[model samples]
Target: MSFFYSSIVKFEIEFFGHENIRSNHQKTIEITKESHLTPQGDCIVGVNATSSCADLPLELKNKLKNSNSKIKFTISVGDDEFILEGRGHPELILAHTKDIVIRKSDFICPRTLAIKCDKASDLLPRTMVSLLQNPKTKGTFTIDID
Candidate 1:
């Protein structure tokens, strides 16, 4: 028998934090294309994002839609860095234009970048979250799938 495997796929996005970033939501972590944020958006850690789900490369999106794919989400801000592990699902559409979300649940949605994530907004380090409350904070989000 013969088998085939796909090569690793990578995508990166840049965004800035907002003054309203709370990062308190228990189930999700999110980055949005919108420049402004309200306190109610507790899952949001970054705003004025350079890329949304709709902007992800098609190759990376394809990998993210595969049920067998493993995903690594790397977040870097100044000197601090965080790594999140997650899995892809066949249900992922990766089509939302305004937001990119990572969820700890298995729920699938247009904005969801990865489901069954190992961490959520509330699980992030408090020090990192504090830095994210400043609009001057710059962040890089890198996604790798295989």
Candidate 2:
């Protein structure tokens, strides 16, 4: 018998913080491709994102569709780096064009990137959130599926 194993898939997204970034939502965190952010987008940490859920590679997306897949989401800005862990679901249809959201709840939507995330925007470090409120801050988001 032949054996097959799948390897981890990883990708990075570059984004810039927006002046309106609140990073205060209790249940979710988000990065958006839109050039502008409203004050009401309290979950948004970064805007002008280089990639949305729709921009992810097919291989990565396919792996993320597996319920057994574990995901690591890392966000780095300046000298601060934060990591969040979550799980993927078979019901995920990651096809949103403008946003990628990680949620503390199991609610799945086109914009949802991961579910049952360990941290939400409100749980982020205050220093990091302050940096994210500045439009000049550069942010890197890395997604790893294992």
Best by lDDT: 2
For model 2, the run of ten residues with the poorest summed lDDT? 2-11
Over the stretch 1-146, how does candidate 2's per-residue lDDT look in tens digits? 99988698989999998888888899999999998888999999999999999999999999888889999999999999999999999899899999999999999999998999999999889899899888899999999998
Candidate 1 lDDT by residue in tens digits, 1-146 = 99887598888899998889888899999999999899999999899899999999888888898879999998889898889999998889889999999999998889998999998888778898899999999999999887
Q: What is the TM-score of each candidate against the true structure?
A: 0.93, 0.94
Q: Candidate 1 at 62: error in angstroms?
A: 0.5
Residue 142 in model 2: lDDT? 96
